[model samples]
Target: MRGSFRRYTRWFIAWASLVALGGWLLPPLVNVERYRRRLKSELEQELGRPVDFGAVSVRLLPRPGFSIQNAAIGEAPGFGDEPFARIERIECDVRWRSLWQSRLSFDRLRLEHASFNLVRRPEGGWNLASLIGREAPARGGTAAGSPPADAGGPLRLESEGARLDFKIGADKKPFAVINVAARLDLDFTRGNVNFRLAGEPIRTDMSLPTPGRVELEGEWTPGEKLSGPLAATLRTEGALLYDWIPLLTGRNPDLYGVLDLQADLRGSIYSFQFEGRGTLRQLHRSELPPPADAMPATLYARGQFDARERGRVVVESADASFRDSILHSSGNVEQVFSAPQMDLVVAVEHSRLEDFFQLARRFASGAGAAGLSGRLDGLVTVRGPWREPRLGGFFKAQQPRFIAGGTTFPMSDLDLRVNETGIRLAPVRVMVAPRVELVAEAVFRPPAPPTMRSKQISAPSPPSAGEPHAFGLRGLQYDLALSAKAVPVSDLVRFSRSLGIRAAREVDAQGIATASFGLTGKVWPITPPAWHGQAELRGTRLFLPGLTEPLHLPHARLEISENRIVVDPVTAVIGTSVFTGRLEHQGGRSVPWTFNAHTSQLSLEQSALWFDVLGHRPPLPLLARIPGIRSLLEQRTAASSLFAGLNASGRFSVATLTYPSVTLTNVVASAAVSGRTVQLGVESFRAGGGRGAGDIRVDLTAS
Candidate 1:
């Protein structure tokens, strides 16, 4: 019995060894080339395309699978000879049990270094339509239908180093995706698919003009009727947006910026709902003019879009933020692919003024910038037919202060309202000093289409054919009213200096003055509108160096008109002399201004007041140490050369004059100045019982 058992065991071991050896050697001995050729033909018939391969190899040990090297699939008939897809290497794994049942069921597929060229024929049918067992429907839609009978079972697909190109007719599109990697699972039985896809990193391809990367995860249930919801989350970060802008707009803004977006997508393939938050950082133009301090910003949006309507977007909520300022808005934009139309309301509440200046500085051109400080609250509504935009809004400043040159103006209540036609400002009251208050009100209207005045031009001529015509300069009109109550002249002098005007620094003015002015005009016209006002000074005392006694004005009144100002009478008391004068000065710039003065009595020692007001100083440096010259030299610098650009003349006469000890009667003089030249004619002079007349000329061209 033992011998028999040993014989059986030997036989069993020998059979097992033979079985293992056969399993290992069968794959090498089988005619895999013939099977490969047959399988290619089967696939061509099933896919309705031509398939070709370089070589094929079979494996039998771990699992039944095939590997093909250098394979390609030809395009559909009439779609050109260019292969639709090509692969350097392809691998497929099949179920072993299914092979015995005469069925080829792919369990796994992988491709390396593959490329696909998809085309849309002139007849509006895609090369891939037949592969998916669906006829091309109208537009981008698919017809309702069940899955084809040949639709395979569930499978997993993976690919690396893949490229995809698209073409319409015979022309290649501008966009192509390169260096793609993806893993996907398709369950045809359950009609569901899930995938993870990633594109090449930015700047990895030198041949690509616009380089970018996309990372996405998506899942969807494809109903039998080809209508169902899909959802995806994607992240795309790239430097491609700058290049893409020109493709649509026909002009490159040459912007240097980085764009990054994280978004969620939900809806059917035909229409989608999107929610996203993104940022544009370090945004500025590189080759053209750009703003300084271009602050980076954040953007958030939730909207719905339909693929069928290519140029419309509906934004349910949109928000943008730069620094401490935020704009919250919602609107519908139409024809985005062409001439866009927008209707939106942007609002901000409780925002800092410094943040607003950060945006305003971009538009400021010079030292005139109103560098303001405080808080702001505002709302702006913008509506557009696109070409003709209309804007309306209002903004309020909470305790705003403007700092410029060297002075500060604290405005307690400032409000601004704007509309399509004009702008209005609320009355503002400012405190300049302990006892001084300034009140101002203003309204401004922007230019409208040229309105023909019967005297200006014949009624607008009709545009000639093929000739472009534009509206003439219409005119900007403004109205401003200002008043100052109980203010000292010293403060006014300081304010003048802050406005780039020179003033006497050696004089100390006392007492209070009240002034009011109103101006209305079309600033664009060569001749501005009329400006008239009045001023009054009461109990004002002025003291200067070298003067033993102060000069006092008990009362003074001045009247203004469109073309000139008239001082009815100004009586000044100096020492034992009293002088009264009526002065007239021409105003406005359409013509040269002139001055005339007639005085009943005058004190020569106090003549420096006229020189001070005229921004002039006598050439006497050493005399400054004697108090009189010091006031003239140290009070203000030499008069500006602005006189060289002005034309002026003056006439003056004094019936009686007192100078220290001498008194002159019937003193009359006339002066004329033009472009660095001065002329003075003494009509007559009587002093010390002698009378004389003469003319003096001064050439100040070198001075």
Candidate 2:
């Protein structure tokens, strides 16, 4: 009995050794040339395309199969001459148990270094739309619809380091995703499958960012039309900004950022929904960091995609949050790849204003968006083409403050808008203490994006019908309009100086002044804005340089321009002495000044009281509207000051001049003024009811 057991064990060991030796040695020796045609036929029938391959070899471990090299699959009809897929190597493992049941099953198949081209025809149909789902030729002489002996069962296929090229018809695009590792568990008999595709998307443009892997795992059941119900979970980290932005906005913008997404996907591969949390951050322009105090971020969002619907995309919900601020958006983009038009609604609820500025800083430019804080809320609709979108609705802020030139302008409210015209901040209301309550409106325009122009240079251009108004495209232009009513003169003067305007400073005034201006320049590069406006004053008293006390002025008007200042004819009275005068100053601080005046019914006592030197008084009661007018004037006159240079040679007449001792009627005087001296020759005078002719000079600057 022991001898018999030992014999059986020895025979079993010999058989096992023979099996291992044959598994190692027989595969290379076996001639698989005859099976090559059958394998090629099977692959062609399965994929419904023309297939070619190099020599096939037998496999022995785990299961019986074949390994083929240099397999190539031709493109479908009407897609030109380019092939569909080319693989460096292919391995197929047949299920032994299924083969014993008279059915050949491909349990596993592997491909290496494969490249595939997917084309979408100009008429919106995929190239592979009609090639799949057709019944294959029966094997082993079996009739159609009858199961063949070589019928294959489920296939678990995998590819390592593959590439997918996207094409519109025969023209391949400059976009492809590479380094793909994919798996497909396909059950041909049951029409059910599970798949996983992971790849890194890249842009072939000159600026090539580091691509990141995006993964999708899903289940699919292909129907007759190749339309299948599919579901998947998609994940990606550090993807290119251009790859994702073109999905919503057709054009690829010049921007820099990283994108991360995690989502559950459902529906068909051609049309599907993706609800995800997406985060974008580290934004910049051409790889430059954001401003020290600001950061660029956002768009954690969700949306839908459809390949068949002209690459249509719908933005169902997009939300981004930073601390207590929230911004939500929803919109749909149609014809996303060609002639894209967007209709989106964005809502902000207590969102940070700095966030908006940060985004603007990443793109082109955001003028006047610095030093901004506070909550912003709005419901804005963005429509039309992406190049020039029309915005309806407004973004507003409450009690925002801005610091400029060492002054904080406390704003009561702000309203901002963007339309086909440009970016506008209309009616930014301010109520600053010690200054005026002002309403400022501004429009900022950067160089517009290039647009397609007509080939004919002489073509008549179409007139742009205004949207009430439009800030024309191109140029670095900033226009500002400011208006104020019943504001203090001191504060107004201070504010003008802060804006780098030449303003009044010598006199102390206490009257309300009304002012408005329209200015235009470039806010960037810090250009001094050119402005034209007018200021009006009424029912106030101010010091005149030639007089010692202030006079009551019924009306005063000033015409101001970029380089000139004009004080129009003004009417004033001092103790029933009516006077009128006009002064003009050109070239700002260079001080080319012109002054002229005439007066009637003047009194010598008033002249003596006004024309005396500083610190020397005539002892008459001083009457002035603005307090400290005399002291201010005296300080200005003490030195060779702003009023030192005067050249005057003119003739004028005062209808009446009178004193307590005598009265002169219809007196004509010739005046000459140079430096600090004024000589007026009384050529003719009517005194004591008689006419007297002489040259009488009075020392008006004396005590």
Q: How close is every model to the real structure, measured as TM-score?
A: 0.53, 0.61
Q: Taking the tens digit of each residue's C-alpha lDDT, what string does model 2 give over 1-703?
A: 9999999999999999999888989999988886676667666655667889886889797568888889888998888788888999988877777556633556777989999888878776676554433333344565333234465566677999999989998788878878999998766556677889999776565355434788989887755556778788889888866556653343454455677878887887788888887677666554444545434345566789997888788998988875457788899998877877889998998777755655555554433333556678888888877565666677888767765446677786788775555667867766545555877887665533336322221112222343223232223466677777888765665554444442244444556777777676654333567666777877766554544566677777887776777788777777667878876777755444565667877877656666435434542243533344345445546323433445555565678777777778888877766555667777787877788766645443433
lDDT of each: 0.66, 0.67
Q: What would the per-residue lDDT of candidate 1 be over residues 433-541, giving only the tens digit for each residue?
A: 5556677776655433355211221112222333221122233466566778778876765555455543344445666678887665653332344566788888877
lDDT winner: 2
Query: Model 1 residue 481 lDDT?
Result: 67
